[model samples]
Target: MSGLLALLDDVAAIAKVAAASVDDIAAAAAKAGTKAAGVVIDDAAVTPKYVHGFQADRELPIIWRIALGSLKNKLVVLLPGLLALDAFAPWAITPLLMLGGAYLCFEGAEKLVHMFAPHADHEIEADFDTRDPARLEEEKVAGAIKTDFILSAEIMTIALATIESPSFWMQAITLAVVGTFITVAVYGAVALIVKMDDLGLHMAATGHTSGSRALGRGLVRAMPRLMAVLSTVGTAAMLWVGGNIVIHGLDVTQLWAWPYKTIKYVATELANALPAAQGLVQWLVTAALDGVFGLILGVILIPIATRVVGPAIAAIWPGKST
Candidate 1:
């Protein structure tokens, strides 16, 4: 009887320890997910466009395919690579993060230019005009997956950096959680966004009440505007997050101290000025400064990327010019 009681106590202790580990992983994943919010937002925003012209029946399947590809990118390819980096070349993480940041800046800047300066939509038009629907779908899915791979790399790296776990297993579990959660969230949102118009149409057609019909009409009208807003928000987020990452990276490496200190000083001053909204004011000031810095850096990088890097990549890859 005494021996049985001792075994029960041991089992209870083990259960408590397991529960604690689960709580720790959950906490770490939540924190890491927050840190990668900007990239996640952009990911959700960008994915819907890939399914834009697909047939109504095919939309969900296409989204599912892309979501699966995204999962594979994060789990099979990126997670293992990240673990290897953490194990062997941990010091390389910051520089790689900076590189990803530069990419985000470039992407945001390019979108800005395309938005403000109207250019020929010939390429897009031509792509849409293709005779082979299957080929077009494949190409679109492939392109989207490629884009997702870059964003996933950024998200995973950011999450890994944010995790505070001492155990390798804990870090691995946290990353898996982050990756699965982000993938499902982003693509699930994309699936909904793409089907919203159809849902609205159905509601308008079949709703039993006038209010339901009116609400459906409103949803139909609102989706395009919502998409536009999302795109704008995503661009801003990318610039803000990218600039902040670069600034912090530079500060970490002792390459530049003034930008970080200057931003902090300004934010602190604003926070002090508005005691009632101190936190909000400080965040806005910091984000605004970071975005401004990002815009400037992105503008500077645009010419170099287009003239030098673009051409070099095209030269190497032949027929893959952006």
Candidate 2:
């Protein structure tokens, strides 16, 4: 009887250790996920554009395909690489992160420039409108997955960097959890955002009650403006996140702290001016500076990316250029 009791005690102890490990993973995952919020928001905001011209029925399926691709991008392609990096060359994380941040800056700044440039339409939509529907869908999904790869790399790196634990398996578990959660959240939100108008139209046309129909009509009317807002938010997020990374990287690389300090001063000034909106004002001031710096950096990078880096990449990859 005593031997059986001892065995039961050992089982209970093992269960407790398992529970503790699970709790640790959950905590780390949450921490890492929160740290990657900017990239996650940008991911969600950027995704809806891929399905824009598709038939309403095809939108969700396309998004599903893209989401699946995104999952594979992160898990199959990126996850293993990140783990390998962590195991072999953890020092490579920061520089790669900064490069990803620079790319975000370039993308966001390009959008802003297009908004003001007179010839924006010449290249903004590109040849997307000319392709066969199926081909276009496939291309767009591929493009989106490519884009997601960059963002996912940044997100995963950020998540990995934010993790405090020393155990490799624990870090792996946390990163996987973070990756799964963010992909679902981003694509799920993208699906909802892209379909809101159709849903509203359906509700307006087929709702059983007058109030329901009215609400549906309102949703349909609201969608365009909501999308515009999301685009603006996405751009801002990209610039803010990008600028923060470059500035932090600069500080890390022993360049200077003036940029960060200047932004902090501006944020403080803005906060002082708006007591009621102190937090918001501070955030906007910081974001605006970050965006401005990001734009400048992006402009500088544009010619290099287009004329130099782009061609070199095309040369290396041959058929893979976007």
What is the lDDT of every predicted structure here? 0.85, 0.83
In terms of lDDT, the poorest run of 10 residues in model 2 is 121-130
lDDT tens readout by residue for model 2, 149-267:
87898899889889999988898888889999999999988988989998899999999999999999999999878878887877777777788778777767667878988888889
RMSD of 2: 2.5
Name model 2 segments beyond 4 Å from true: 116-129, 273-275
- Candidate 1, which segments miss by more than 4 Å at Cα? 1-20, 49-58, 120-143
For 46-107, candidate 1 gives per-residue lDDT tens digits of 77777766788989989999999999999999998899999999888778878777777776
RMSD of each: 3.2, 2.5
| Model 1 C-alpha lDDT versus the unseen true structure | 0.85
TM-scores across all candidates? 0.84, 0.89
Give the CA lDDT, 0 to 100, for residue 273 in model 1: 92
